[model samples]
Target chain A: MSPTNATPPSERTRVRRVAQRGRYDRETLHAIVDAAYVCHVAFADEHGVHCIPTACWREGDHLYIHGSNGSRMLKLATHGAQICVTITHLDGLVLARSAFHHSMNYRSAVIYGVFDIVEGAAKAAALDTFVEKIAPGRSREVRPGDINELAATTVLRVAIDEAAAKIRTGGPRDDEADMTREVWAGVLPLAMRPRTPIIDAAPSGTPDYVRQWHEIASANAAV
Target chain B: MSPTNATPPSERTRVRRVAQRGRYDRETLHAIVDAAYVCHVAFADEHGVHCIPTACWREGDHLYIHGSNGSRMLKLATHGAQICVTITHLDGLVLARSAFHHSMNYRSAVIYGVFDIVEGAAKAAALDTFVEKIAPGRSREVRPGDINELAATTVLRVAIDEAAAKIRTGGPRDDEADMTREVWAGVLPLAMRPRTPIIDAAPSGTPDYVRQWHEIASANAAV
Candidate 1:
């Protein structure tokens, strides 16, 4: 259902530092986007370059974002301005025997491209994709966006063609001479954990998604 | 320990959409930075614009970043290129009664400025501050960076004068028309949680930081 193969890197997508950690395969890129709830998008305008964080989702080979029709970012993207979107998950802190060798365990994806305005039927369909992503069966329960509400919003998507994923895992790599130092070395892991759901109201029964949110997240972390 | 008051916003730092959520106080800015382990930096180069994620920490009224001297971002930053640094903590997903009103609860700080290179003793001291932030007393235990190691790294810091923080919390705000709909509405809260520490080696006893990592994080989340 996603991009099936890796694409050749463009001049901008090539990873220069720690090149071995770079990945170009679509599978790697898709997994990174799927795990994230938001991404930081960078763009340049008359004032200067700006980086803004916003909710994002993936469908096939494109990454989608929506905002008020008056949003400066959406307005700029609709004009075909180039932009960079990045998502990062900080997994842990890597502790080493030497200060110089300390590092972080993380998974990150960077995508570079221009966004195209999604309109008409496809725009409505895309909104459904986003709602379904956040709360599986709840999309059906919620009142769908009215014509006026949908008209007041803008939806945009960029192809995930020129993207790269970089990942670092495992323990710290300390110099041989420093390894014998009397220090406790290891990793202190971190995760985006789901907490107890705070219900505003539930005239209907709690859906499976809300009921199992914390349990599913805990199980995933254990793996 | 931080900027004492809120400063007037520059043209680029002002929040335009949903302006009520904007925050300008230094206390708010510093808290957002302190809670983050990383930030996405956006800078434009000859190749085009880029958004790169990197480790970051705060000290006084400045934010500091360090990297290998050969890093292109570091090299360009040292030359005084204008950049945008943004740190965001995703707190929860707000599920509204209607699809149009779904939103995310997050705390985000966006700073705009050029970075100044850090050198000599100040650079070394700043690195220690970073290490201390990650693991309180571990700085004294690890073998300090040697002269050569210090020479191979580049440190940079930017003034936090031109910055703004935006935050949203609690339950979703549904339109009156949609509120009576039969949808389970509220927030599905999320947090960056600490898992059990994984030890690679322990020649010395486990420090209080490592021993209390999960407990401390869990307590903070409860608040």
Candidate 2:
């Protein structure tokens, strides 16, 4: 109902002005995370901490991420325990004259919360959501997962409670004194777009749903 | 020098199969980490573990990463504690008919180690390595960081003792039964290429170093 507040927990996570290069509102944050198909998830354990890049999808206000059920990290994350999920898209390299100022322009989101494992019907529903997230209407076009396959997968749900999004997009920021130096400086905008789809050797009947979905995705230049 | 033999701590952290993808060899691991300009760092505190994506570069077997020196995670990491560092390049998205089988093809490296604050000359050297890692030859082109600028930055050195690299390339791997299904399946290879260089408004002579660097980069698309 009310506007969802997506604020950083502490001053450390709060982005500074120079580092804050784009809109930090909730809409922008959700849009970037939802549009992305893969997210690099990082978490801590008794042996220290580790991060792995994996695929993720959003369903409503929550995000569902999965990995092999045997994964120790996934097993630990399943008890509705608090964890951190981060998704990032590197836009470009900010080449500054000074090494200290050399940086990257990127869009990233950090979600801090407890993730509950989805099982039974909820699990099936979550899997469907994952499919639809990639291809809006392709879920119905393919056969559903069997019990054996589902048993090997683990899905954890993280509610969007405490979160923050930071983005930097633009040309390099050269110092006034160094501005006249003979060096190249400008933004090379990085974007992802869907290329020509490779239809299977034998397609059922080019599903109307897929056709319409790709049409809209192409129009929006989304991969 | 003999190759550095640093084994990633646990079995889960150790990469399996596809030896090229699982570069446990120190030379290979350091090369990949040095070439990358950004890393997704994951750590935990009172609010749970969180992952923040930022720019990073390596010098020797040690990695240098920076952020607000006052950051909670940074402060925690500076205690010579272990943390997770991951760098990934999403080469392509593998779109499959069934959602359960859908996956992304990418190259990713994960490192776990204690981070210590680099001071004095060590800090300055790390900074130069950071610049050279990103642009190869740009460090000499610009003014180096002064004491005041260096004071404002917080640089942590993560030694490469426990690390692993995993990569997946080529077309999609659909199940034999699902292979005949009527759906699109293949890779959309992602590649990054530098566009025309935009020389700074004010300039010195186009440095031979810069020109030669571009030639080498264009010749090899490894980065």
Tens digits of per-residue lDDT for model 2, B1-223? 2345756446646764334457666776776776666788887766567787777887777878876666666788887656889887776666665666776677777888778888888888877777766666778876788778888778897877677777776666667788777665654444444433344332555555446544533442322
lDDT of each: 0.91, 0.68
Question: What TM-score does chain A of each model score against the native chain A?
Answer: 0.95, 0.80
At residue A83, give the lDDT of candidate 2.
74
TM-score of 1: 0.96
Against the true structure, whose lDDT is highest? Answer: 1
Judge candidate 1 at residue B116 and give its lDDT: 95
Report lDDT (Cα) of residue B213, candidate 1.
81
Candidate 2 Cα outliers beyond 4 Å, as residue runs: A1-13, A16-24, A174-177, A180-183, A192-223, B1-12, B15-23, B192-202, B205-223
| CA error at residue A205 for candidate 1, angstroms | 1.8
- What would the per-residue lDDT of candidate 1 be over residues B1-223, giving only the tens digit for each residue? 2335988888998899998788888999999999999999999999889999999999999999999999889999999999999999999999999999899999999999999999999999999999999999888999999999999999999999899999999899999988788888998999898877889998988988888885654453434
| C-alpha positional error of residue B109 in candidate 2 after TM-score superposition, expressed in Å | 1.3
Error of 1 at A106 (Å): 0.5
Kindly report which residue stretches of model 1 are placed more than 4 angstroms away from their true locations once superposed. A1-4, A214-223, B1-4, B214-223
